[model samples]
Target: MIKSRAVIARGKGEPVEVVRIDLPEPGPGEVLVRVQACGVCHTDLHYREGGINDEFPFLLGHEAAGVVEAVGPGVPDVSENDFVVLNWRAVCGQCRACSRGKPWYCFDTNNADQPMRLEDGTELSPALGIGAFSERTLVHAGQCTRVDPAARPVVVSLLGCGVMAGIGAAINTGGVTRGDSVAVIGCGGVGNGSIAGAALAGAEKVIAVDRDPKKLAWAEEFGATHTVNAAETDAVAAIRSLTGGNGADVVIDAVGRPETFEQAFYARDLAGTAVLVGVPTPEMEIKLPLLDVFGRGGAVKSSWYGDCLPSRDFPMLTNLHQQGRLPLDKFVTEEITLDEVEDAFAKMQRGEVLRSVVVF
Candidate 1:
């Protein structure tokens, strides 16, 4: 075991605490990683706020890029000194989803069986099974997806979560293709990623809908063809008008709010696809007209981690970034220390930055 300073959330609605913790050595099927950089994802904030669950003193931070430092017994594919991006969904190939040949939807996922503990020996729950807000972390071997070390760690880490979700929503779930018209609601990290994905997939028109002009500007940089300020106009009407009065071929609701979902529902062309990539609170509910649902004649789907297979998509996207084809660098607004996570959260809430990455 080794002592590592880590960010820990002790309780619900409590401020995160940066304290010393004991990290255990990796066991079978596990690998130890020296975290190089980690993205301060909104999900980390959600975990601290207890929106995710009651698990606390939760080890916070998950979107990370690191180098393998050690390998456990029986591990074969990875070795020390390899650079990798951490993934939450490490597929268990024996699961039903994998049996059906869709490993991305694998029913069972795995993580490090051992737990990191406090100095007092109190067991700590790692957020999303990653717990990467530290100098190092232990993870299942499958959680490590090797990538080109030349890529920026801060930018590539974002792909392990929100960015991947957005891109997958457009390219994988929504099946966006060349010449298709696409509309994305919400201008956050995930939404902007969808815009990029749509652009990469050769969508004829990529419309960005959001309340913030700053976020809309970022969307344009990521490859949006048109912008709609929802606060100033009817989003559905504007989308339809921009798409030749027929609505977009695919509309993605990245906001996950009832009103925003309703807008996405109506903003699609006849028989067009609707993808919901945003996460919602449990207390919120939506009551859509059943007739409209029947008439829509298209799929309304939720993208789980962008329905991405990390092993396949990670390398592909990283290669694109290396080739200067993908603009991953646009996502990094600032680099921060682990101690400034709370401040970073404030900046995120205030929309001051796209991502505040913790660079070790």
Candidate 2:
């Protein structure tokens, strides 16, 4: 067993703390990763607030990049000292989704068979099956996607979660292409990622919608061609007006709320796609006109991790970042130590930072 210091949320509505835990050696099909950097994501906050489940004493943090310290038997894809970005969707090749050639939606994703435990032998439910907010962690071998060693861990780590989701929502889910006009609601990390992805996909116009003026400016930096302050303007109307009164070709709801989704539903052209990348609470529900739904004549899709295949997307994105085409580093709002995770959460709630990464 290896003794590692990690961040844990003891119970619902409790503040997270750094605690020592016992991490067992990797078993077959598993690997031990020495986490170099982990991003403090909103999912971690959801875990703490019991929004995801009643799994208390949860191990938080998943967006991470690290180096493989050891690999268990039967692991041939990676070796010791390999730089990697950790992903939650470790696709199981035999699942029905994988059999259909849609491995990104694999029903049976892989995780470590053994558990990390507190000193008293309490098992931890790792957030998103990763729990990478530690000095080191144990994960399925497939969770580690090898990336270029030349890229900085702090920069590339964001690709493990929000950034990848945003980009994928535009390219994969929204099918954004040249001459398409895209509008993304919410200008957080994921929303900005959609903006960047839309630009990368050759969209003619990228409109950013957010109540915060600061985030709107940040969206522009990520390639948003227009800004819609939802606080001062009707998002759907602004989007339609910006698209020459026809609405956008693709509209994305990164906020994941009933109101925002309604805006996205109405803010698209007759045949435009609408994507929901943000996570919504279970109790949250929306009522829409049945006629409107039928008349819209477009698809309504939900993006799970941007429907990305880590093995295919990670290395390609890392290469893009290395070539100076993608500004992955711009997502890092600050670099903090493990102890500051609680404070970082507060800042995140206030929308003060895009990402406060824990650098080990």
lDDT (CA) per prediction = 0.93, 0.95
lDDT of 1: 0.93
Candidate 2: 10-residue stretch with minimal lDDT: 321-330
lDDT of 2 by residue, 1-360 (tens): 899999999988988989999999999999999999999999999999999999788989999999999999999998999999999999999989999999999999999999998988999999999999999999999999999999999999999999999999999999999999999999999999999999989999999999999999999999999999999999999999999999999999999999999999999999789999988899889999999999989899999999999999999999988998888888899999999999999999999999999999
The alpha-carbon deviation from the true structure for residue 269 of candidate 2, after best TM-score superposition, in angstroms, is 0.2
Instruction: Name the weakest run of 10 consecutive residues (lDDT summed) in model 1.
Output: 320-329
In model 2, where do residues sit more than 4 Å from their true spots?
none
Evaluated at residue 273, the lDDT of candidate 2 is 92
Give the lDDT of residue 76 in candidate 1: 88
Tell me how far the alpha carbon of residue 32 in candidate 1 is from the true structure, in angstroms, after superposition: 0.5
lDDT of 2: 0.95
Q: lDDT of model 2 at residue 240?
A: 96
Tens-digit per-residue lDDT, 144-211, candidate 1: 99999888888899888989999999999999999999999999899999999999999999999999
lDDT score for residue 266 of model 2: 96
